[model samples]
Target chain A: MRTILFLLQKEFIQIFRNKTMLPIIFIMPLVQMLVLVFAANLEMKNIKMKLVDFDNTATSQEIVSKFKASPFYNIIGYSYSVEEAQNSLIDNSADLVMVIPPNLEQDILNGQSPKVQLLIDAINGMTAGLINSYSSMIMLDVNKDIAIELMKFSANQQLKQISIKQRFWYNSGLNYKHYMVPGIIVILVTIIGMFLTALNIVSEKEFGTIEQINVTPIRKYQFILGKLIPFLLVGLFDFALGLFIGKLLFGVPIRGSLFLLFSFAFLYLVLVLGIGLLLSIISDTQQQVMFLTFFITLVFVLMSGLFTPIETMPLWAQRVNIINPFAYFMKVNRMILLKGSGFFDLIREFLYIGIYGIISIVVAIRLYRKTS
Target chain B: MKALEVSHIYKTYNDITALKDVSFNVAEGELFGLIGPDGAGKTSLIRIIITLLLADSGEIHLLGKDVVKEYKYLRSRIGYMPGRFSLYSDLTVLENLNFFATVFGTSIEANYNLIKNIYSQIEMFKDRKAGDLSGGMKQKLGLSCALIHKPEVLFLDEPTTGVDAVSRKEFWEMLQELKQKGITIIVSTPYMDEAEMCDRVALLQKGEIMSIDTPQNIINEFSEELIEIKTPDLYEVKEKLRLEFGKNSAFMFGQSIHFSTSSKSKSKELLNEFFEENNFNIESVNIIEPNIEDCFIKLMTKDS
Candidate 1:
């Protein structure tokens, strides 16, 4: 235990003495959090729309006015021809186009339903889908107003209709930043925990200091635990800072118990740092460790459902994520912060990560040999 | 009991043999040297004995403990300074020293007297980072760190390989002081002249031990008469002499040529007559004593 304390003292001195690495540890996470949360947004607004009205009648004009009043649509201009409206879409100036046919009022007065054609740019499938839904909702509102007016004129007192209402439960406003900040915090914690520990031991190998330590009386478990504790503290500190930034800058809610969140974060960091130690043991150079960690963390972060929902991914990808610790952390982070999930709700993730941490550390220590 | 004992040690990397059937013993309190050039298996032998590397097939007993089986207990009883500068360069000198002392589960105050002779030289620069120190100072710090634990045996691999001439001499003097304290020291060096400082040395070459004995005894064992000849055209004269006396007989030593002959009498006269026939400008010729390097070359040539 005294030997481990000495090792920790040495490691901390080396870590803090590195002037270049200080900023990378403390400031890079803040910059990433402030930038990625806002930049990675998928919410659609101000969709550029083009209106084509063949019937220059009052009803068609009223419909065009209704679209103009909506906040989601930005009408660039009116086109007299359908082909001209399509040219706007092809030129990338318009995201959506609505065509009101001629005799649209005559068909309505004759109790015949008319068709309104919508020409939407389907290049980006998600944005095109949003535009289609928004335009359809506006058209439905116009139909309702027309139906009520016609019912009053015909003295039909009994008209039956089924109306559906939606209320988003957790994220009422559907703010993308709220959903992204917690996930980005997972990434921040992972980078600090994994990359630093991975590079630390490999640098010692490159410098030949590890050989000196290996020849000492220190046991393998003592040496490995000595390396683990300092970085674990640093990882937790980075996690706290990330949480503070998430709450301050993005107004990300922390509805769950802070104690439970931190306890789980501690476990998650151990798993990450354990893997880092394992990589360092197998690699001889800092460059090799860096490449290996980078490749692995890249795969984990992408499959982590940070940018895309894991449920919507292919079945094989979802299966692969069962072993991805980042995915577990990302899900738990969102659950605790946004959904206020309790400890019992995240019991499975806790058990898997804890088991993974213990196994990786054991394997790392077992694979580390004092002799070469 | 012997401080270190090895019998028929062998080690190989892939298809290349590093140490082949090598064996040596160091008595307690003896200052021993493994003298050889680079790639001569000096480091390999030292590493195997120190428990930092495994031998292919051999038995090594350090302080009567099996090196492979009792490595964990033996580690605390031995100190090693590898060929490279292995101290933490980013750490201050005192911090590096203190850290190693703590790692060995001892305090500097407890072992302060052991490293005082060496550590006091750089005591004023204790606050300076090790990486910012000179090469000689870095080596001194490494020695101090190794000695901080007061191990029974100390292994130094090429400690003076890159040090300055003055620092190299000082390093040897320090080793002598440590030897007086009765700690067995096994140091490896490529410098043949450094062998004279050791109580005993094993001249190693191509993964084999050429000879093992005291420096004086090894020098006295040279049975052939050696003649040194100086000429203006040294290379030309050397090549001519090689053709006449065979390749292993004549070699360039410094600015002159050393020619060895098994013919005891009138060898110098024969060499003078040969130089005269070749129209060589010979300054002079005289019988000279053989040094360790000469003995090594003779053994190497004889073996090949």
Candidate 2:
């Protein structure tokens, strides 16, 4: 135990003495939080639209005015020629173009459905799909109004309709930042916990200091724990700072118990640091550790549902995420912060991460040799 | 009991053999040296004995404890200073020393007397970072850290390989002092002069022990008479001598050429007549006593 304290003291001194590392530890997380939360948003707004109406009627004018009033579409201007509107789409000036053909009011009055054409840019498949849906909904509303008005004048009968209302359960406003902030916090803690621990021992190996330590009476467990505990505390501290930034900057709600959130975070950190230790044991130099950790962390973050929904991914990918530690924490972070999930709600994640942490650490200790 | 014992130790890395059937023993309180150039398997042998590396097939008994089977208990009883500067460079000198002391489960206050003579030399710079120290000072700090635990056997691999002459002298004196405290020291170096300071040394060359004995005995064991030829053209004289008498007979030693031959009486007369016939200016030619280096070259060439 005394040996471990000495080792811890030595490690902490080295960690703090590194001038370049201090800023990375304290400031990089806040920068990542501020930048990635706002930049990684999928919410689309201010979609530029060009309207080409051939019919100079009140019905055509009403549709143009409705498109202009919606918050999502930014109407560029009215074009008389359909060819000119299509040119705007080619030049990327407009994301969508709506062309109403001639005789649109006469066709509705004569009980004929007039063709309303929408030309949308399909470069980004996702945004194009959203634009199609929004424009279709607007047209549907316009059709219903005309039908009701025509019925009132023709016959004294009321039209029966079924209206649907939507209420978003957790994120009422559908704030993308609120959903992203917690997930970015998971990434921040993971970077600190895994990268630092992975590079720590390998740097000693490069410096030839580990050989000196190997000859001493210090047990393997003491050495491993000494390395693990300091980074664990640093990771937790970074996690807390991330939580504070999430609450203060993004106004992300922390509805669940803070204690339960931190408890799971501690377990997840252990699992991550354990893997780092395992990497360090297998690697011989800092460069090897850096490349290995970078590759693994990149895969973990990308497959973790940080940017995309895991359910929407292929079936094999979802199965692969069962072993991804980052996915578990990314899910639990949102669950506790957004949905107000309790300990019992996250029991399965807790069990898997706990078991993973034990296995990795035990394997690390078993592989570490005093003599080779 | 012997401080260290090895029998037929062998080690290899892939196809490259590092130590080949190497064996030696160090008595208690003896200052032993493993004298060889780089890649002479000096570091490999020391690492195996200190329980930092495994031998391919061998039996090593350090203080009567099996090195492989009982490494855990033996680790506390031994101290090793690797060839590289292994102390924490980012740490202060005092912090580095204190850390090693604590790691061995002992305080500096407990082992203060053991490292005092060496530690006091750099105690004034205790606050300085180890990386900022000079090469000599770094070596001194490494030695101090190794001695802080007061182990039964201390293994130092090339402690004076890159140190200045004055500092190298001082390091040897410190080792002698440590020997007086009843700690067996096994130090390796490529400098032939340094071998004279050890009580006994195993002259190693290319993964094999050439000879093992006291420095005087190794020198006395040179079977051939040695002749030192001083001339203005040293390289030419060496080449001429090698062409006349085989490749292993003549080699450059510092400022002169040393030629070894079985016939001491006739060789000097023959060399003078030959130099005169070749129109070469000879400064002096006299039979000289062989040093450790001469004995090493003779033994190394004999094997090939």
Candidate 3:
């Protein structure tokens, strides 16, 4: 343990003394948290919708007004013909074209359901799907109004109609930034833990200092632990800074216990640090470590449900995410911060991350040879 | 017991052989030197003995323990300075020294007597970054760090390769002081003059040992008489002499030709007659004693 303390002291001195790396370590995460939270938003807003009302009726105008009032749609233009609306959509002026039938009010008054055609631009498939669902909700509300009026006139007070109401439990306002801040914070911690440890060891190799250390009586496990503990501390520090920024800038509430969040972060950092050390052990130069870390981190980040939901991904992608530690942490961060999840609720994630940390560290130890 | 013992050690990298059936031994408190040129397996041999590298097949015992099996125990007792400047360049001199001492489970205070002579030279600038120090200062720091643990044996690989001549002299003086403290030092260098500083030297070449003995003994073992011939055109004199006495005996040595032959009297008589007949202006011709460089050249040429 004394030997480990010495090694850790050396590592910290080297890390802080490096002029180029000091700013990167202390300030890069804050910049990423501030910028990425705004850029990585998933909420679909200001969807441009064009109206092609052929009926010129009260019901059609009411539906159009509802869409315009919901804050989700921007009425770009009103077209007299379906062809004109199609032109507007083709010119990128509108994303949704709503064509109401000529007898929309007449059909409703005669107690017959009317048909409406919605021409949606599916270029962004996810956004198109959302627009479709929102437009259908507005039409359903108009139908409910007609049905209630008809039921009162017919004196059918016992008529039954089923209506579904939605209540967003955790994020009532559906703010994308609130959900994204915690996930981005997870990414920041991951980048710091993995990149720094890998570069640290590889730089030692480049400078040929490992040979001097290798010849000493320091045990391999002791050396590995010494390297891991310093970076783990740095990672936790970065995580705390990210959380502070998340709360200060975005006003993201931490509903869960702070202690629970930190303990889980500690476990997750061990996993990331193990991965970084393994990468360093396999690489011979700092440049190789940098490139490999970049490629692997990119893969983990893109597939870790940081921006998209893993459940909606293909089966193959979801299967690959099982080994992605970032995916597990991203999920747990949201669960704990947004849903007030407790320790027992994250037992499975803790188990997987712990096992991964153990396995990666074991492989790193096995591959790191004292003799060459 | 011998401080270091190796028999029939061999090492290879890929298809290239680095150390071939090599063997040597150093007695306790002896200053041993492995003298050879670059790529002559000097660094490889030193690394293998220090347990930083593995020998393909061999036996190595240091301080009466197997180097491979008891490496952990041996490591605490041996100090190694690799061929390159391996200390952290960004760290201060004192920090680097303190780190190595602490890792060895010892304190700088414990080993102060051993490294004081060397460390005191650079102690004033102990706060300077190691990379910012001069080449000589860096070597001093390297030596100080290596000796910080007060190991039983010190392995320095080419400690003076790029150092200035004055610094090199000072470094050997420091080593001599350490020898007085009964610390066995094994140093390797390509500079042939350093062989004379060691009690015994092993001359290595192309993964093979050319000779292992005291520098004076190696010089005394030269069987041929060495003749130094100077002339206006040394290259021409060399070619003519090679023609007369064959290529094995004649070599160029800085504006003079060293011609060796079995019969000195006959060679002298022939050199004067041959130069006169060839219309060459002879400057001086005398018999000179051979040094380690001459011995190594002879040994390498003989082996080839």
- The pairs that clash in candidate 2 are none
lDDT by residue (tens digit), candidate 1, B1-304: 8999999999999999999999899999999999988999999998899889999999999999999999998999999999999899999999999999998989899999999999999999999999999999999999999999999999999999999999999999999999999899999999988999999999899899989999999888898898888888899998887787788888998899999977788998898889778788989999998887788788778956
Which model scores highest in DockQ? 2
RMSD of 3: 3.0
Looking at model 1, residue A22 earns an lDDT score of: 87
lDDT score at residue B70, model 3, on the 0-100 scale: 92
Global lDDT of each candidate: 0.92, 0.92, 0.90
Query: Runs in model 2 with CA error above 4 Å?
Result: A80-84, A106-115
Which tens-of-lDDT digit does each residue in B157-234 have in candidate 3?
999999999999999999999999999999999998899999999989989998999999999998777889888788
Candidate 3: stretches off by over 4 Å: A50-63, A78-121, A142-160, B229-250, B261-265, B268-285
lDDT per residue as tens, model 2, B1-304: 8999999999999999999999999999999999998899999999999998999999999999999999988988998999899999999999999999988888999999999999999999999999999999999999999989899999999989889999999999999999999999999999988989999999898899988999999988887778899998999988988898888889998899999876656788888898998988889999888888898888878867
What lDDT score goes with residue A160 in model 3?
Answer: 85
Compute DockQ for each candidate against the true complex. 0.84, 0.88, 0.79
Whole-structure CA lDDT of model 3: 0.90
Candidate 3 per-residue C-alpha lDDT over A160-187 given as tens digits, one digit per residue, 9 for 90 to 100: 8776889998899888888999999998
Give me the candidate number with maximum lDDT.
2
Model 1 lDDT vs. the true structure?
Answer: 0.92
